[model samples]
Target: MKIAIIGAGAMGSLFGGRLALAGEEVWLLDVWEEHVRAINDKGLAIAAADRDIVARPKATTRLEDIGTAELVIVFVKSTATAKAAETALSLLGPDTAVLTLQNGYGNAEAIAAAVGAGRVIAGTTAQGATLLGPGRIMHGGSGETHIGELGGGLTARLEKIAACLTRAGIQTVADDNVASLIWGKLIVNVGINALTGITGLKNGELAEHDETRQVLALAVEEAVRVADAAGVKLPYGDPVEKVLAVAVATAQNRSSMLQDLSGGRMTEIEAINGALVREGERYGVATPVNRVLTLLIKALEKLPRENRP
Candidate 1:
């Protein structure tokens, strides 16, 4: 399979390298010039669950560099979805399968609009990864990925993609209601991301203080209500409890939103809490905490880059 990953940041690089190592022809495409040069020069440096690297896979920033790909997996930030889609359109002919595994909400819809719903399969992955440096990615956590068609119904081709990911070490599951699965993941992220981001602390740090716990409760409560109204079933216990449990599980790890804030890059806030607020308003259901988090993150985004750290 000619697998291609767009946005070769942390998770993208990790998957690309592992697949190539597993004997899959993987191509990594990124917008960052330095990263492109780094991978082209020094094979992707993976240093977490397994060490060392694979150099056979090729990488580039130019869309042309990513010729025809049978399956294209998008891993770019949520905010850059449109741009990536516009650039990636050239890489698709008619039968290319395009999948998005980026965090947050509304990703599937955007990708579907870009490349027709019939060619899109959305997935949510629990496997955690972080960028250590140019071309270096640290895969720190173990998790499963659920893949399915966005608007329901599936085929032999979806099965083929799932089989390939499973053999490459990314535990996989195929579900028809992939939309609900993605929402479940979004609820968990909304519960944890901003609280950890604003406090400049790790996930476990939220449980250390009552105020953080309160914020978590407020966000999850409204998120659950919003999700329930939207007809989605979460995969765990109370949304808040599940997120706190995840916070405790990933205690030492910093939330990715916080990493973006610390790096002065735009976050996926709009797709998380921001998505909630927008939906709540559409349904005439208020989502105050989500609104506040969205505002705060936007405020943080407005700050001069040098001052963020």
Candidate 2:
């Protein structure tokens, strides 16, 4: 299939470059001029646990340069989703499937606003990547990706796309209830991302501190209540336990939110903790811990790069 990877950051590069190496027609679209130039000029430099790959995938900053594709995977920041979606509209055909494999919640809804619900697919990935430089990404951890139709139509198509991803060494699951998967991902984000980000600590550090553990439980409890009100299921039997388990699994890894803070790139706070806070107000779930966490992260967001912790 002709594929377009919108937002050609580290994760996008992983998907696009690997797909291209697997002999798929892949185009990477992004606004980062240097990243686009690096790929188009020198190819994308990719290194994973299993192997190192250099893929000469097509890349461009021009939205017009991205033509029609059977699938478009969007990895843009939640804050920039609307603008990215507006630009990516050019690459969508009547049968094109647009998927958001971003870190936070509410991305699918935003994409649906631009491309219609039937064409928008929401996805979640646990794979981690660190961009060492323009056109270079270090695959830090292996993880699964789940994709599904938002308006509940393209099960077969998403399954086929999952096959392609798996063939390229990115394990994928096509689920009918993708919202549940997204909510599960949100639970992990709410538990560690902002707290670790604001504290300048890694995931394992949270468990070592009693204060952090208490706050984590509080925030996750509030998030669970908030998610329940929205009719979203927490994937694990116990939300707090599940989130802590994930923290243990990726103990040494810095969250994408932390990585964004380190790189001075914007965080996906609005779609994460902010989403919980908004839904809390809508559902009267009283998400005070989540609210405080969101406020703290927003404060860090306002600080100058030198002042940011």
lDDT of each: 0.82, 0.83
Clashing pairs in 1: none
Runs in model 1 lying further than 4 Å from the true structure: 49-56, 207-210
Candidate that scores best on lDDT: 2
10 residues in a row with least lDDT, candidate 2: 244-253
Model 1, range 203-279, lDDT digits (tens) per residue? 77898899999999999899888888888887676778877877776676677898898888988998989998988
Evaluate residue 123 in candidate 2 and report its C-alpha lDDT on the 0 to 100 scale: 79
Worst 10 residues of 1 by lDDT: 48-57
lDDT of model 2 at position 296 = 88
lDDT of 2 by residue, 177-209 (tens): 878888888887888899988898877688888
